[model samples]
Target: MLGLESLLFLIEVGTLIPLIKTNKIKYNVEEEGGCDDLDQGDNGWKIIHTDVFRFPPFKSLLCAVLGVGAQFLTLATAIIVMALLGMFNIHRHGAINSAAIVLYALTSCVSGYVSCSFYTQINGQRWVWNIILTSALFSAPLFLTWSVVNSVHWWSGSTQALPATTVLLLLGAWVLVGFPLTVIGGIVGKNRAGSFQAPCRTRNIARQIPPQPWYKHTFVHMAIGGFLPFSAISVELYYIFATVWGREHYTLYGILLCVFAILLSVGACISVALTYFLLSGEDYRWWWRSVLSTGSTGLFIFVYSVFYYRNRSSMSGLVQSSEFFGYSLLTALVFSLMLGSVSFWASLAFIRYIYRSLKMD
Candidate 1:
């Protein structure tokens, strides 16, 4: 993803120029005493630069979610790259499934590390609680959803329902292996955690956000933001759906690799553009907005799933419907979190770079 990392870098070269010029102009003015009351009167981005890095609301919950989301993101990417490189038996059924399950169980360390490190940086006190939340956040929801769907299959006497032994094995793996790894990672991450450093010093009192136009509203930007990222991979998305839902065989690993890169690029660039727009409009509540904006790609995906279910596929029966929609929801939610993290991290880098460019006194 080194190339993909240039997403904001590529777009910001043009967009941030105006932002840079404006700051330079302001910089020349601030050299004198005329703009001494600038902090009080300004509705520009620099005013809120301080608050931008403030620990987000629900700091513990947010950190845990981000940690788990990031772990899954890494896991997904790793599995794809490994499959692309032929490190596994991609042609065999259940090979990918088995590998993914094993890798996910092992990646609890990542979840714990990121969660505890982030929580510590935010000055959080309850490290154990935060790590526990991180480990359980995604897995708990998934298990519950799986259990419900499996029960539905069981009632219909379908073979899709997991066996009792399998269920017990899964639980045992998580409790015995995943849980301890998470605890170890949390301990290490806390011990090695760094201080939270902001690009600018936050003001004692938060400045009231200036009124924004309707067009600049979060949802409005999100719709456009989501569309761009979703469009980038719509073609590949269809193929992915076909492979998952139909009898389509996807052997184009190279194309899949390209699409993966494109997905990250689209998500990062769109997020940076949207974040820039919001910042220019003097709205600083971008923490969740950036995530929601790019994550809305999942919304577009869910809509596509509906269309696929109704018109494309002839899938019928309670078991099929339950499985299709159940897994679809999980897929969309995971996609949202994964891409949302990519977007947020890209936006964070863009903000940091822009702030660094500023001639702050």
Candidate 2:
């Protein structure tokens, strides 16, 4: 299963690279006053000035028709093969589960690469950061699942050990099929949308006033602004470890988790809105500061993980196994990445909103 998961991940990565290169996802830009150094060229202005603002939500209708449309082709192929096999009744669960995981994983990689590439092109962020973050988000779940499987002692008492052929097939699938799929996905996304670079423009020095002091710096604002979101996230971590420490009653845990998530999301929105309101009043320094709120979650998760490890007695025996420890670390790492990703994107969107609000005048 681990090998199969790896294969799926690789395939998604393979597919993502090309997509990132080609796809031109729409990005919002602030149109500056017409170019000043106007040499009378064929097109009136010799240069164009523009500022990148928000990235619009993926044009869902178009994405549905093209991006998802292509993947459906593969889905249809899988359905056809499943129909041909008389053993469908017996093999249905394993086959469908494996296919679904691969398909979704591939889709995520493609979407991420496309989105990242588009943003990188617009903002001129280094390509390395784009690729690294995209890869981390798409492959995070796989590593988490692997950690869970490795940590559990299936052969002890009643746990059934997986057969040898299953393991081999899983390995083969990732190496042969998954890796190729990911690479191809990336390439396709990239090819469709090239990188974004903000167009340069000349500004009138006389008209421009130095941005106000409270609005001139981002650091302090960002650090303080991150608190609400981080607090909500820490509340969440408290319960997660509470459960891992042996409270298995889902009734109470489930409700609290849902509440925690909702409040966290809402808090994030409010923080952004507040920041935007402040920035709109000419506070330029507050522009990117609200985004720091999400970073608090990452800090809390790290601290909570320490407590979880120390308190969970069942995990003690597993800790003795290098395999179990490896799995535990993997699980922690992936969960942290997912949470961190959520915070980052939320903060980014908020900051973009603030940037646009400030520049609109």
- Number of the top candidate by lDDT? 1
Give lDDT: candidate 2, residue 54: 24
Write down the TM-score of every candidate: 0.86, 0.47
lDDT of 2 by residue, 1-361 (tens): 4698899999999999877754332222235632223321222112112212223332222121222223333443444355344323432345545765556445544544453444434443344444444444424545555545643645453243455576667656655655455446545655666543223343342122234466334444444544555555565555545543444422243455455456447545755664554444433332133333433344445555666566743555542344434534544443333333344345447554433343342
lDDT, candidate 1, 79-169, per-residue tens: 8888888876545647877887888889989889988997898799999899888888878878988998999999999987899999999
Clashes of each: 0, 56
Per-residue error for 192 in candidate 2, Å, reads: 4.5
- Top candidate when judged by TM-score against the true structure: 1
Error of 2 at 344 (Å): 4.1
lDDT of 1 at 352: 79
Query: What value does the lDDT take at residue 53 in candidate 2?
Result: 29
